[model samples]
Target: MAVNIQKGLAAAGLAPLHVWNRTASKAEPVQAEGAIVEPSLESLASKCSLIFAMTFDDAALESAFSAISALSNKSKETENKILVTCSTVAPSLVQQLEHKTKSVSVLSAPVFGRPDAAAAKMLVAVLAGGSETEKNLVAKYLEYTTRKITRLGGPAHTANVLKLTGNFCILSVIEMLAQAQTLAEKNGVPREAVVDVVSALMPGPIVTGYSERIARDEFDVGFTVDGGLKDVGLMRDLASSSSVSLPFADIAHGHLERQKAENKDLDWASLAKIVRKDSHL
Candidate 1:
């Protein structure tokens, strides 16, 4: 995200010269590239036009907010502050985050795309907030960094809902690919052959990538196995809250759990590995 912002900032001549992270050492690379490293999250929050929390889950989101809340309590005067959350979390939790940040304007602005896409300034930022003023301000701020910007409803959760929905679709595709590869490998057909056929007919990059991962067992460091499990877990929770029976989600959730139990460090795409291995591929 920092890299993405850097590229966008340079393009817009709004270069970010100051930044911070949970791991102070992680901020070194950016600092080396002409960005000032802030002493603390509080200091960082006070300095920036907008502070983005691109954390993993609801728990992480709450922890960041806890820090911000502590800081807000210390200062009597508050200026133009916006907490742009770029994390994939439940909408309800985002509302809680918004309510918790008393002085700062909270906006749900989850972004789509991986680190590489972000580095290229091609991320899709989805913005949603009750405050149109804040939302518009965030949209403009995001425009300085991302290629595409989507504005959602008049609530902070809208962007999070969109992000979760998109993740569900991605998980669905991965689950299907896993089963398909399992079926293909069980028969005389090779997984690659099946993938090639599917790629030619369907032609989605995600499916194509997962197909290769399943075939070659190449679930690496990108999007780890634990993360996949967490996402599937979130999908199940969301489906349950909506009173929807998603059998496929259940199966996917189980697959993720099994993968975690076996090889916790595997990449998320490695969910396909579980199905393939179970079928003796």
Candidate 2:
């Protein structure tokens, strides 16, 4: 994802990109692509006016923010710095970060796309920030990274809420596809035939791509089961906090847990396998 973001930026003529990753060697390739690899998070934060972070979870985000906060304090240039967090963390955590940090302008811009979509620069970015200026500032750079940027025009964390909800919807679609495909196969219908019917009806990349993968039993980890579980868990927590019920989330969560219990390293679309197993197909 980081590599694609950098590549997109470079393609858009945004040069001298600076990047840092926990695994330094992983960033070496990005450096070879003209991005300057920073030795540490603090160095990256200090050097870049606009910094984007795409960490795995809240802990990683907090760690990155800590380094950015330190840089803000040390440099006394908080007003000039903008921190754009692209990680799909809980909205509450983003709210907490905004509340805790008064220096740099923090924006939530979680993206929607697979790595391939990102590589193609077709990612959709959901953006929210403290102000229009802040949002616009980040949007300038994001324009290069994503195909579309939708501004929520509210607090920074609102973008996180939208992102989580959007993820839940995607998971719901995956579950539906899983169950539907399983039903088709069990009823003496070919999986490809089912996919062909759905492809005509759905006519989108996600449906077509995932359906093909599920039909071919090609669960090559576009998104891991663990990652899907994490997002579903986040959705469940958020839903609970808001007194909303998500039965499908629970079902997806259960499927992921079962898959994890079996110690299977599988893609998220492998949720179809749960239904396939249940149907004895």
Candidate 3:
């Protein structure tokens, strides 16, 4: 994802990027693509005015923010720096980060898309910041990395909330597709035939692409079951805090947990197998 983001940025004439990764070997590919590899997070933070931290979870996001904050405390030049967090995290985490760092502007810009979509520069970016100026400044650079940008306004956490909810919707759709396909297959209908009918009715990438994958049993890791479980857990927490209930989320969570128990490394699409197994297919 980082490589694709850098490639898109370079394609949009935003080259000469300073790249760094915790694993030095992983940064090699980005360096080969013409990005100047930085030795450390502190070095990258010191040199770049606009830094993007795309980590796996909130814990990693907090560590990245800590490095940036330490640099900000030591250098006056860091005041105007912009920190764009592209990781999927809870809205409350973003709020806490904002409160902790008053020097640099924090823009919560969680993205939506699989790796292929990101490589094609077709990812949808949901952005929120403290001001329009900050958002515009970040969006101008991010345009190269995404097909469309949805600005959610001044509150930084709004974009995080949107990301979590949007992911929940995707998981719900996956669960629906899994069960529907299972039902069709058990009734002497071919999985492909069922997917074809749904594709004709729905006609969207999510439906067409994922349904086809489920039909083919192509559960390669675009997004892992564990990753889906993490996001769904976050959604459940968000709903609980707001005195709301997401029954579908609970269902999806259970399916993902079952999938994880059986095969710990399969993609989230493997949730389809739960339906198939339940039907004794």
Task: Report the lDDT tens digits of candidate 2 across residue range 72-118.
Answer: 87767644577889999988888988867677778999999977787
**Candidate 2 residue-wise lDDT at 210:** 87
| By lDDT: ranked, best first | 3, 2, 1
Encode model 1's per-residue lDDT on 75-179: one tens digit a residue: 665454677888888777887767765576788888877777767667788888857877776787677557898887767887887887787887888889888
Candidate 2: clashing pairs of residues: none
1-281: candidate 3 lDDT, tens digit per residue: 66765776687787878988888998888888888899999999999988888888899989988888899889897766778999889888898888786777888899988778877778899999867887888887777658999998668888999999889888888999999988888898898998899999999898898999999999985888888888988899899999998999998888889999988578898988887888898
* Full-model lDDT for every candidate: 0.76, 0.85, 0.86
Which stretches of candidate 2 lie above 4 Å from their native place? Answer: 4-13
**C-alpha lDDT of candidate 3 relative to the true structure:** 0.86
lDDT of 2 at 239: 97
Supply candidate 2's per-residue lDDT for 86.
94
Q: How many residue pairs clash in each candidate?
A: 0, 0, 0
Model 2: per-residue Cα lDDT at residue 149: 85
| lDDT at position 127, candidate 1 | 83
